[model samples]
Each structure stands twice: as structure tokens, then as C-alpha cells.
Target chain A: MTRVRMDLFVSLDGYTTSDPTPDDPMGPDWGRLTAAYTATRTFRERIFGDTSGAGTTGVDDTYAAAFFEGIGSEIMGAGMFGLHTFPDDPDWKGWWGDRPPFGTPVYVLTRTAPRPSISMDGGTTFHFRNAAIGDVLAEATDAAGGQDVRVGGGIGTALEFLRADLVDDLHLMVAPIVLGRGLRLWDGVPALDRSHTVTTEVAESGTIHVTFTREQHA
Target chain B: MTRVRMDLFVSLDGYTTSDPTPDDPMGPDWGRLTAAYTATRTFRERIFGDTSGAGTTGVDDTYAAAFFEGIGSEIMGAGMFGLHTFPDDPDWKGWWGDRPPFGTPVYVLTRTAPRPSISMDGGTTFHFRNAAIGDVLAEATDAAGGQDVRVGGGIGTALEFLRADLVDDLHLMVAPIVLGRGLRLWDGVPALDRSHTVTTEVAESGTIHVTFTREQHA
Candidate 1:
């Protein structure tokens, strides 16, 4: 089955980010916040294109490797695709320089007008959509070709998918820091325990990897 | 040196408890939320006074037992002492019927009048105080007699101590549930990572025991 999975790097206080700025890119605390995730060998090899093969090979690395495995398509919001920062810039492909990490067909949910799809160097291609979550998920699921569809987040898009009960699996990497104020991931999702079978795995980096899979009913 | 510590049973979304009503004392999901904690032998013997010696002894029980050890005095908000639930009732000792677990001097932070202290059947003694966090902490510290002073919580109280930077050590038991709306524990607490070093341990009960300790500065 083509599952709808989400991977989020969240703070201990439940914030995804502190709001992006032009100077800070993802936000002021972006570097320190994603330290554990970026230190993984999988992140180095897959996301950063660090072909030198230098990175930590721990539990976090294992999860990082699995994050890129079997994911044929991705769905993300405009903010995640850098549209929030470069709304007026037509040439702005994404934050992921020349070689974007996502080698799958990526769908960007935005309110912008329909534009031609941007094909990156890798197998990745950007397709913009301004439709309901169901419609977008359907398109992304079909594009997945029986593989899993990874719902990339900036909190807003993740909340929308989770609120609509559209996510099959959710992997939340809880960083040790507390962001205090920002876009909280669990805003509208009430009583999530009743819906999912929850589990927690602690990494050597002190990140608590909590996974929630929707329960199957009889 | 004896450190002031805290132990909180919190939801995955960082909520301590939902709005408590008479119908739902610890909110609607209280039972499922603290199931593992309350099921421990330490909780059974100390809290429920169950002498039958029937309870699971595991990693969760290890933390549960540690929660009771190395604590001389306790500090909590009026709500945690059940003063909010039974505010008008002059005879309300606490939610713990007869033998309250806290054998140490338990100071309840409230704005009520200066009344005589209530000494329970156990070593627990309830004293009311309307002073500030500094004053109360000082009083509790003195009463601790070189032992640790536990800052017990109901979210609001814990936040007050945390915001004031009075807590030396904090242990948060992350339960696998989300109560979407409630008094959040992390509100107003920004850049907590700058002060504390955090670590996490996962139990068989699926609870993520996260600890934050103030880093010693030379």
C-alpha cells in the first residue's frame, strides 16, 4: 500500500521553526536545531550530497537513511519550498541549491498561479498545486507509483494533513531545545493517542524519536 | 549540592493536563495518560498505600522509584494540592484521601489566608504560602535540610518556577497522547536550551523520560 508518511524535526516544545528570515533562511535557530539530524551519514550522503562519506552512523543515521528509502513522491507547503521567502522571484527553484535532496516528484501546495513545472538535475521535479489536501494527496499518491508519499513540512502543511486524518505514519524527531513560540505542530490535532499506536526511541544525540502510526480498526 | 528537581507527567504535545471538571478529574484522558506511572509499584505503595506487593518492576518502575527517592520537601501549586477543585471547602485536605504520599513538608502556593497547617496521617504536612517564588523556594530549601526540594506541578506552577529559572533539574515523562487544548507548560519559556543540557530515555511503557539539568559554569 502507498502510505502517507510525515517526517518532522520538531523542538521539545513542539515548534517546527522560529519563522524564516532572509538572513537566517530557515530561522535563527535553524543550524543548532537541526544539528543532530544533519550530523547523520544519511543526511550527509542524501541531503547534503556529501559523497566524501563522513558523518555519524548511529540510530539517528539509521532513521535518516530510512527517511529517503522507498519514498517515491513528496508533498510540501510553499514555505518549505522557499516560496514564502522568494514569493516574487520567478527564478527561485528552492532552497536546495542545484541538486535538491528529494529525487521524487514533489508537489508544492501554494496559492500562486499555475506555472510550468521545474525539473531539477536529479529525478526531482516540482509541481505546484492550489487545491484541497485530498486532491493533492491523490495526485502525489499516484505519482508515488505504489511507493510511499513523504509529506514534507513547515508545520502548516503537516497540520493540515494530520488534521484531515490523511497521514498513515508520522515520525517526529523531538529536539532537546524549547523554541517557546512559533508554529506548533500539534495545534488542532486533539486526542491523537486515540487514533495512533505510539512509540518512542531515544537516540545517542538525546533526540527522542517518537512515531505514531494510525491504528487499524476491525 | 542537593538540587531542586521536578517530575511531570505530560502529554506528547507538552500539555500537563486538560481542563479538569468534577466529571473528569484529570481531564477526560487522565487514566490512559498516567497509566504506566500509576501502575508502578512505587505509586501503588506510596500513593495508593497498596501493601499487596503487586505491580510491574521495569524501567518505568525504576524511574518511578527514583521519583520518590532523594526528595526531602515538596512544592506545588494550589491546583496540584486540589485546592482549586475544592477552594471553598474549608475541610479539603487534598485529593489524596488519608495517607498522602509526600512525607516531607508540602508547601502549597496559594493566595488564601494564613491558616493552621494540616498534618496528615503520614509524614506529609501541608502548609499554605502566598509569597513569591523566591520566598517560597527559600522556605522550602530551608525545610529540605540539605536534601532536594521537588517542584511538583500542574503546568501553571511549573512554568512559574521554570520561567523564574529556579528549577535546577527537571524530569518530564512524555506520555503518548495529545490533549490539543489546555494550559501548556512551555509557554513564555524561550531559549531553554541555552541554560540546560537535556537527555532522554525510553521505557517499555513507551514513555520518553526527558531530563534537563542546568549546565555547571566555571
Candidate 2:
């Protein structure tokens, strides 16, 4: 029983990301949006390789740890894969450095011509695909080997799967901020609680974790 | 200290209200947005006058109880008072019954000509005023007699006070649902945590209770 999972960080007002600059490609508000998640011990261990364990340990850390678990394959947009940032850089890999946090086969959905797969130092491999969402998901599912196929989003790609009803679990980390700009994640989606079992928890740092698990899948 | 407090119910997607009709003046999504708050024990006791104690008592009920406490006077928009629904009906006295919940001076902000104040059965008086937000707030404060002056909102009227930096405490009941439409309350407001002590707690009904208390006021 393979499940499609997605994790998104957004402001309380529903803004995902804001204006991007040369230094911060993800956007200026992206840091504020992801402050709680990044302030977790698990994030320091998995993302920054801080083995000293010098970060907040609570619900936020638990979610951060769960984010990297049970994900056997990944599906992300070209933006998440740094294609939008470094479009012409043939030598460019991704923002995740030589060894990305994902230790699985990652399918980067792009509209450009297909490029050869790139295997990193870790157990992660990036496969560029110029195909439809369903086709790409099928490939990602096959690569998952019955595990969860995680959607590594930049919001646009995640929304495509969500609007198409392909996601089984949608977890949103809402920071206590009023980001006046950027796109809302749940713009055209149906009320989640109607079809899914919605659960919410507040982290010690004031980040609200809301998860909508599909009732059928649950 | 006479703090200017406000309580708002909105979807997790930030929509305060959706397409309204003659039947549901607040909107179709109003019920969905306010389900958790309305289901609280305090709401059942205060709003509906249900003395049987037949409602959930949790973090939501605590907040619902606080909503009516210390609010000596309130200022609300004309829409919230059902002015838009019944323009010509001189006898229109709002959705709340003869004994309205707030036993205080309720100032109805409207552009129409001021009418004689309607004093309800249970200490509730509707004073129609067509003045600036500050002026009405000042009048409401004076009527409060050193107690807290609450901004009873329908989004439009609430934003006026919020934008004008008149509110010292803002509490939002964020239901775990996507409305997808209507107006966002914090569209242009700065990040709350920057100037206020923002706290979040999850109610048993999955409704996230976020309170932004002004640090200066605190």
C-alpha cells in the first residue's frame, strides 16, 4: 500500500513563499516561513549534519524527523531541483549539495528536454522527466517499492498533485506570521475535513501543524 | 488596562467569509468557519443561552468564554448587524434575538443616516454611527468605562481598527478547513510575532487558536 505524501510550510495567512532575490532564491519570507521546521534538532541532523544535537526538541522536531522517514521515492518540480534558479548551468546539480537529504530515487518533473539521471554521493538519484503528472507519479510509485512517494514541493508542483486528488496525506506547517504576498496552497481545494481526517497540533515555538489524512487511505 | 480585543473565525486558508445570500447573510462558509467556536460550552451558554451545559469545554471553550468577558462595549460593521440584508426594514434588529449575547453598548458603524439607538431586552444597545474608525472606537471606549472595548467584526470593520493599530489583542479561531474564497483578514498587516507575543494552541476540534497580544500592552 503505497501512499502519496506532501509537506508544506506556509504562513498563517496561507502564503507559501514571497519575492526571491539573488541570495535567497526560495524567497525572503521562505526563511521566516520555515523558521520552526529548520530550528528543530532533526532538521539540524538531517539537513545541516549537526550531530551535536543543538536545536529545539518538541512537536516541530518530531515532524521534521517524520518528514525524512518512510519516503522511499520523491517527486519534485524543476524549481525544487534548482532548474529555475540555474537553468543554463549544465554543471548544476541542486541546492542539496553533493549528497541530498533524500536517500531515494527522485523524479524531477520538468518541461524541458530529458537529461540523463544523476546519482549523488548518498543513496539519492535525480531522474529528470518531461512527462505528465500521472506518468511521473507512476514512475515514482514504481521506484518507491511499496513505500510512500513524497512530494518535495515548491507549492506549484504540490498544488498540481493536490488539485488532481493524487495526494493521500497533506501536512501543512503554518507559522505565526502574516505574509501579505505569495500564493495560497489550498486555493481551489475542497474542504479537507469533509473527505479527510484533519488533525492539528501546535509546536512549542507557536507553529501550527495541520495534517489532512485521506479517510479511505487512513 | 482597557485593552482593545478582537475575536475572528476564519478558515485555515484565511477566508473570513464566502458568497453570501439572503438566507446566510454571513455566507455559506460562515458555519464551517465558526463550527468549532459555536460548539464550545461558553458559546452554548452565552450565545445560545443553553443552560443545560451541553457543549465541548476545551481550549476553544476557554477562548469563547474570554470573548465575552471584559468587553464593556463593542464596535462592529453594518454588515455584521444585518444592515445589508434589510435596508428598508426599520424594525431589523440584527440576527441576535431580543436578548443579545453582548450585554454592552454595541456601536454599529454604517454610512447610512444615524437612527435612534435600539436597546435590546437584555442590556444590549445598538447605536448606529457613521464616523471614522478612531472616532467610533473612542466613543466605544468612553462607553466601556475603562473596560476593554471589543471590535466585533465581519472582516471589513475589523480590518479598519487593525490597520489603524487600534487593537491591542487579536485572537483568531482558525478552523481546519479550506474556504478558498472571501477576504483575508491579515492581507496588509505586518507579521504579528514581530511586535506582539504570538501564541497558538490547538483545540480538540482541530481548530487552531492563535492569539497575538501586544508586547507593549502585555
Candidate 3:
């Protein structure tokens, strides 16, 4: 069974954007956070489809190499995929242009009906899944080839999984900022009794990295 | 004429929430950020409806107090008003309880037919408006009685006003977080020739305060 994990950066105040969207005002810090993930040669080559300038060396790069090593496939919510309405037209690819960042098979959960899969460079393909969360996770896990399944979030999708206890390991990088208002991460979920045991904590120049594993209920 | 100013705290890259919704792994910093705002008397009283200990003595407190002092009316997007579907139910008040933060009139912009105004405690009333952005701003300004009109956002509504160039002053308190995905502010707006002059920049305990005034175009 592939363990599902989630990795993302958030503000101290639980907001992701200052204007209800994903654009944050903290520039270099945000770049540093992304650099942490993009620094890894394997991760970069796989996601960006560009092997040039591949062997970058940095603290974030080293950590990113380790982070991406275990992931097999990814599942992202419709909102995380794009701001445009789901069942997007054929002309509308995504923010990542013709070559998206994810090289592996990606499943986008939406309310739309079945559509043809989108193929991009670097072996990346996008498949829209309108089924329930459990079915989508199962499909992603099977496609992952015994590797861990990663839940790339848009807050709403992450909550859906959390409510179903589908996520296994969690890694969150806290940025020191606050969005007074926007889409909050935990706005509507019912509280759960599960406890998280901190596995690791690291403070980098851009963000504070913390990893948590859900403890088994007594 | 009343100036419409929007004051908000954003990250360097321009994200408003750590996660798009309120269910991701928001760490301990969330509490700290919430405390930063709740420490302010105006914010506290507006959201929680508790007027106890509402005083501006410290420098941070003074800045927050002055920022929210003279807002006559508020304009919010459909998402910010409530999660309910528009033109479906007129009874859905909002996420906030009976007494919302704003104690004046609130105009909610939508594409559907307008609903009758619903009065609330503390002199707050909710009025649904399906008019054009200019019309809504005009109505809000007229209702403001010479006081500044505060434009509350959800992303869609904020961009509408920014694209229309109806806002006079924009205050963004840059927090130090980045959400790599979600609704982005200024996403689809065309690049304009307008310029903004920084009026003030302050670094508080947790966030940086920056104010920008749009220069009048000839």
C-alpha cells in the first residue's frame, strides 16, 4: 500500500494568498520555498521537463531531492489545477504552459464528466476524475507503481481527504505572514480526534519546515 | 466623492491563504497570526462583537485602529458574502453570525437578481446588488456619507474594482508566506500604465505594513 503525503507552505495565520488567490507578496521568501522543491535535479527534470542547469546544489535542493524521491503519483483538486472553470476547453492547458511541472501521472478531481486525458512533455499526463475521493485515491495509488501517492492540495480537496482520514504523512512549511482574509485551510471541516506526532522540524531561510505523522488512535 | 481604500496583509508573492480552504496542516504560526489581528481592538470588536479592552495604546494598535476608523460601507464579492449559491436562497446571511464585522450597510455583487436587504444587529444590513461595478461603487459611495468606502475582497470582487480603476488607495500589509496555488490576485488583469507611489512602509512585530497610492493618469 502506498502512503499518501501532502507538502505545501502556508502563512502563520493559515492564509495562502493575500487577495484570495495564490499570489503572495513575500517574493524572495516564496521563491526560496519553491527553490527548495525545484532545486533537486530529479524533481526539476521530472516536473519542469528541463534538464538544463539540473545539478543545482543548495539546502533546499538537497531537501527537495529527498522529498521527491518517494512520490509516485499526484492528485490535485480542480481549484489547485487552475482558477478557470473545470471541464476546461482544449485550448486551456494550465498556468504551467505546454510543459507542466508534474512529470508523473496527475489526476484532477472535479465535478465534470469524463474527458480525454491531456498529454504533455516529460511523460506528464492529466486525467480528470469526477468520481468520489476514495476512488480517485485508489486510481492514483495504483498508477503510482508502489510509490507513495501525494495529495497536492487546494485546501478544499485536502480537507475532503482529511475528513476521510486518507492522508498518512503531512509536511508543512510555515511562512511568517498573515492574510487577514481569504480561503482558510480548515474553514469547514468537522474536528477530528486524531493526533499528529511531529517527526522533524527545520527552519530554513525562507520557511519553517515541519513534518507530522498521524498517530494511531488508542 | 468618497475614496475606496482596501487595506489587507499579503505575502511577498501575493497569496492570501496558506491553503485555499481551511483544512490543510496550518501549524502553530496560525495562532500567532490570528493573535496579531485579534490583539487589535477594532478587528476584535468587529468580528467577535466583544467590545471589552478595545483601546489603541501601542503603536501597532494605533496603526490598526486608524486603518479601520472611517469605513462607511463595504462591498464584497459573492464568495465573501456567503458560500451559498446566489439566486437560490436569499436567507443565507453569511459565515459570520447574526452580527457581522461591519456594522453598516453591505452591498453584495452578483450576477443574479437582487434580494431585499436583511437588517442585522449593530446597524448592519445586507443588500444584494446585481448592478455593474461602477453602479455598485456609486451606490456604496452615496451610502457612505462622505466616509471612505472599504472594498472587502474574495479575489473576484477585488479584481473587478482594480480592473475598473475605481480604487483610490491600496494598502497591503505584506506577510511572509506563499501559497503556490489557489485563486491569484491580479491574475488575468491586463498590465496597465498606471503607477503607484509608496506612501508608507512599516515593519511591525510579525508583518510589514506598506501603503500605495495610485497616481492620477493624465
- For candidate 1, write residues B1-218 as lDDT tens digits: 65789888889987877887644446776776688898888889877779899876887899899999989899998878887787788888988777888888999999887657999977889999999988998899899998999999767788888888888888888887778877677888756677888878888888888888887621
lDDT of 2 by residue, A167-214 (tens): 899899988887767777777776666777778999998899989899
Q: In candidate 3, which residue ranges exceed 4 Å CA deviation?
A: A1-218, B18-35, B51-59, B83-88, B188-194, B215-218
Best by TM-score: 2
For model 2 the local lDDT of residue B91 reads 87
Order of quality (lDDT): 2, 1, 3
Ranking by DockQ: 1, 2, 3
* Deviating ranges (above 4 Å) for candidate 1: A22-25, A215-218, B22-25, B215-218
Query: Looking at candidate 1, what is the lDDT of residue B66?
Result: 91
At residue B165, candidate 2 shows an lDDT of 75
Candidate 1 lDDT tens digits, A1-218: 88899988889988888876644446776776688899998888877669898998998998888887899899999888888788788888988887788888999999988767999988889999999989999999999999999998767898898888888888988888888777777888856667888888989998889888876621
lDDT string for model 3 (B102-213, tens) is 8888998877666778899777888889889889888998999998888887666777877676777776554434333434454444222235454333334445454556
Candidate 2: clashing pairs of residues: none
